[model samples]
Target: MTTTQDFPAMSGSLQEPAPFWRRRTGTVVTSAALVAALFGGVTGGVVGALNASGGGVAAVSSPVALNASSTSDVSTIAAKVLPSVVQVNVRSGQGEGLGSGVVLTPDGRILTNNHVVAGAQQVTVTLSDGRTVDAAVLGADASSDLAVVQASGVSGLTPAKFGDSDRVKIGDQVVAIGSPEGLQGTVTSGIVSALDRTVTVPGTSTGRRDSSVSYQAIQTDASINPGNSGGPLVNAAGEVVGINSAIYSPASDGGQAGSVGIGFAIPSDQVQQIVNRLS
Candidate 1:
């Protein structure tokens, strides 16, 4: 489930927003049946049976240790943002999807990719501390492939600070945090590779996985995978700059093709615009 791999897979044009659905880098399981569900109901009884295993914001001032040129700032950024990030596992009657999300409110608002929870009858969200909570879809937009969910029993949490994507520059150091292939709390470091690039991806919320949506994106070399969808891409200062939404892959099945260091995220400015409309 690591994004450190830098190799080319099948040659061709690039496809966007496909879940890092391949074999999971030998760690993530795409099928909800095989992956370890952290909660009951849609996530299976695993979490319920165990009563859940154990386990956000500046309540966020920036971590002072961050050094853009030192290379060690990746951890500082991850530590500041991971608390707001979560692992999302969803199940519908016929199928399921696994992805990551970020907490937006102390009272349980969550933001994630539409493809991850689309049509899901059941959704289980695992917090950074390992506690799992059931969630319900509140709103979804297939056109942008973004969605929001509401979780029960949460309050007074730290929210992620949104950054101005228009200010993001090429080669800026960044960090991506997500549960790639169901592996929670995974962090990858890289630089913004491109910005304002248009990407077209199939719609997962409508069940028409073959359909496509076009939107401007923030491209980064940070390691993002199939399960990394909807996760946050934070800057050196720990403010979320974009939502990791898609990646450039060449596989036809889409699932078989893996990341080649090129990944795309929905910029925070656009994300905030959409969230404002939905919320």
Candidate 2:
């Protein structure tokens, strides 16, 4: 029996500027020069956007000299948060898919992307320690692209700490945890490349109401890919600040494809609202 979860307000908007490195230049400059320009501009935009959001540009500090103590570490973070991160598998009569999710409550409430389990006949959640459990839809919001699911007979589930995304600054280190390409419990690290980036996600409905959702995301070069959707983007303090969403892979023929050291994650502040509604 196929079940459909209704995701209200599950879309978002896009706000990154046109990558400047692809522009044409004077006769003297070669194609290589264009590529260099593009790389520089994209990188600069990432940093600039963060600065702009954080108020103003500050002096660049040396990475070596910065040593702020935090309760988050690889072993500690993994042990504490891994059980919360789950593998979401959706199966319909005609198709099947796999994605990532996080346990938001001890009583089986889980958080994931609405699109992940939108039209599944059955949904299964796999834990980090290899426990698979059947899951039911709690509520979904399409405009926000967020969903909440519930599992029965699940115990000892650890919920993740939600961080204030608005307090994040440029150059802040971040960690992404999820199942990329079906590989569960994968972890990647990178800096908060940008913030307040608006991306347009295609709306669920058609016709006049077929508008897009504007999302202010946290941009990073953390190697997020297919199957990583809905995973948590954690801060140095091991708090989740964003949810891994989309990648800007232009077409190869004068376009972009794959990770070119650029990736995006939805801000946790926005996600918290949807999660709260489900709770």
Candidate 3:
């Protein structure tokens, strides 16, 4: 029962909605089961029981101080946006994963990559203020690797301002925030390396039925990793232009992974559609 309040969502979405499976269980059962699986066992029960009676979890409010030449107003942007950013943790029988997400509405609607929360029996979202809350999967589209989750018993949440990803060009600076390698609230900065690039994402049984979707991505040099998926890719203006999705690891080392100064993000225009549908 080691309860990690904040987990990060990674990856991003692509154009054209892909078909996905819907969980049949009611939101209550699914959420309860998720919490139980994570905090009910002997290892988890102690923390779960403690938190269950210890009132609600506190939220993290401190924002990361980002430094970039073009971001002279970085403090204003970070302060305005940090409240909407959240750390997501997904747990299943096998193990747990981490990623990041954006709160889409004041009522606690959040958007993140389907791959980040895929196969998760339970999901918990931690706000920037250190408050931890249970989340429910509203809908997930695996083909696009996008999913929407909602948090309960939380209010006054800030939503991220969306930017035009289509207008983003190569060489523009971008920032990413997520829990890389389980280290929560990590931030990295880089420039858009490429645009409208297409890459193939290996299919998952739990992913969209389309088998694969070609992405119109914003390539960057940001240090994206397993836990950085589903996080926001912000432009120099501090607007969310893309969602951090994947990185290209050279095939040289027998598929051993390494950053080659290349990473990709799902364009924001496409994300609007999904978020609108969820809202």
Candidate 4:
């Protein structure tokens, strides 16, 4: 089932569609035994999104340095950041969800949205290098909508550098990297529309704001679609500033879904704290 969240205060004569948290579905909890289910070097469709963006993509064979010196240009930043971003495919029994993730460490640690991997029975991470590896969730925090997963066996990983969201100013140039509509490694560009915006989400509990989860978000005008969840929202310098989480679907055509040039992300500062505990 597709679910969304929005500002309850802005109710109109015709209620608008709530912004969707994640475009996909699935909530079956799997055990750690899943780590041994897949055979080594045996690749199967992991049910993921394939990311593609406006600018051209660099060859997956070339090693793009995550710390490469980058100017305030979009292509330059993408070349550096793309190598660190990954496509996350999760399956929970008969249900499956698609999302994106950023490499947090050279050892294959990944950071993504909790809604993306929550209750996932199996997870497969596809690197920019065209290799897929098995992943296991370390921990998930629903309050922040963030989660961390670690690869069982992987090497030569390129980790994205996260920036200080506290010093981020409004109108700064930014980019969104993720798999939109099953397109993996897609990049989109935009400016920071707002800062520290308060957003409420439908939580594990039911009934309106009583049991909702709120988050301090970094708002952007980037085109983040359903599959973009858990991807990294990076700065012009190729540093990750936030984790792409939700998008604002406008009240049009009976509330058409997808990004309407309005997207929200969990600030990197909050993500850092969550990943710290997971690591």
Candidate 5:
């Protein structure tokens, strides 16, 4: 039996998936562990959706100005995409946890994993300019593992350019950006190893045993870890194609699950649809 466990949620629940599909030959494993990439020790506080607009993603900034011939340039892509990504910090009754978010609109609306801000009492985000600002949860959907948060009174922010996930092909170069282990502005690069991978992760709410979220994921080899949840996985054109969500870990890793070159992301096309519903 293949074993899959979600990265540590704030509650540290051990979630298992339905069944494992054998795609690679000679890759025999008795169990597969899928862990939530969001932090575990720090739980988020609960918040209601404040007044937010369901405005579509803005085409602000020039984050897609890479050379057409070379979409795999990490340095160029990182510099352009970094500003649109932010570090999300949550404080709750249990403790404080940190994750990552992608800016959706210029007026401070952000997109991140629902688990990142789930159960959070207070939420704040640090922009790439090193400015930290208070934010509020606009809405969260545990079913889709997506959420929308808005930074208070913020403007002139750079929104990420979302790409067409449907057009993402296997082996295409991609970049992952987020704060892992509280290290903000971290960047990692890899290729899209697979597509339409089914990933199921537990919700962030406490005391709900049946609370879980499942979605078809874009699998990549990027180095994703705890606190990298909700960060953007962009294509070579600096377009956000997916949101880094979960990773596969060997059962023997002893709970110290880091990226093993098999990370999964929520496709950006789904992200845009959910953000619209939440916002």
Candidate 6:
């Protein structure tokens, strides 16, 4: 019955969209049964139930920019970005849920998915150096599925360098970092499989059942899982091009969901736009 994990898919449009089957993360069962749906104006297939699943601009200062042409190796990228990634844990009367986040400022401003902290009463974040600190939600926008949390009395934290997602192209190398299944600081690599993908998920700004949050997501082959939500999907240059969000997992016999190479991230530009407001 935890709320942070499930992210049921919704339908929308793209200039030239293609049909693709999609689903949410986690195995936690909710009240509803699984149902089929379309994504991006194409009759893809059924979108799964909620598993129960950053930015830029003038409002926030930028991190040191890495040389995009210098390297795209996983180790180098992970080394540069790891310090900014964190494991986010939330607790409510209903229960607890886990996700991830990216540090936005040295003073401890963080960027994460709105669903990760939705309905959360207490929130804490584990930094890359194994420090768990208390945090307070500064703002949350369900329509964009983005949020910002500020850690108490923390300073000198490394903020992630964000790249321009609009410049990302298919076949570009990318790396995803997050805490999957509570495993903090895990790193995975893949390519930009597609772009301008319209993905709709089950929550919205109005908190209405009929309304959904539709966003243009960056499609990738990176192995994203449940706890990976809100993590950084970085480019080879060690700059975050997107925020790792959801994955499209086919239903298995046990009804458990895992990454099947089809993962989606909220474009960094959109993340910047939303986070600039949230932070």
Return the top candidate by lDDT: 5
lDDT of each: 0.60, 0.53, 0.54, 0.57, 0.63, 0.60
Give one digit per residue, the lDDT tens place, for model 4 in 31-110: 11110001111111111001111110000000111222234366787888889988777765435556688898899999
Question: Model 5 over residues 1-279: C-alpha lDDT tens digits?
Answer: 212332332222222211111122321121223333354232111111101221101000011222233544778888889999998877654456677889999999999877677667788999999999999999888777778999988999999999888888777877678877667888777777778865655444431223546677777776776677788888777888888766655434223345667677888899888788899
Candidate 6 positional error at 19, Å: 27
Which residue runs of candidate 4 sit more than 4 Å off their true CA positions?
A: 1-72, 204-210, 252-256
Model 1 over residues 1-279: C-alpha lDDT tens digits? 112222233233333333332222232322211222221112211000100111000000011112285655666677788888887777654445567888899887888877667667788888888888888888998777788988878776667777777777778877777776567888777788777765554445554353456667777777665467778877667778788765544323212334567667787888898996665
TM-score of each: 0.76, 0.70, 0.71, 0.73, 0.76, 0.75
CA deviation > 4 Å runs, candidate 6: 1-28, 31-72, 204-210, 252-254
lDDT of 2 by residue, 200-224 (tens): 4433221112234446666676665
Candidate 1 vs candidate 2, TM-score winner = 1
Off by over 4 Å in 2: 1-72, 205-211, 253-257
Estimate candidate 3's alpha-carbon lDDT, on a 0 to 1 scale: 0.54
Q: Give per-model CA RMSD.
A: 10.9, 13.1, 13.8, 11.2, 11.7, 10.5
Predict model 5's lDDT versus the native.
Answer: 0.63
TM-score of 5: 0.76
RMSD of 2: 13.1
Which pairs clash (backbone N, Cα, C closer than 3 Å) in model 4? 49-182, 50-182, 50-183, 50-184, 51-183, 51-184, 51-185, 51-186, 52-186
Task: Answer with 5 or 6, whichever has the higher TM-score.
Answer: 5
lDDT of 3 by residue, 1-279 (tens): 111232122122111111111223411121110111111111110000111222110001111222354454555555566677787776664355456788788989998876656667888988888888999888886666577999988888988878877777666766667655445666666677667755445322352122544455666776665455677877656678877665543322121122345566777888887776655
Per model, how many backbone clashes are there?
A: 6, 31, 30, 9, 20, 11
Output the lDDT of residue 220, model 4.
Answer: 77
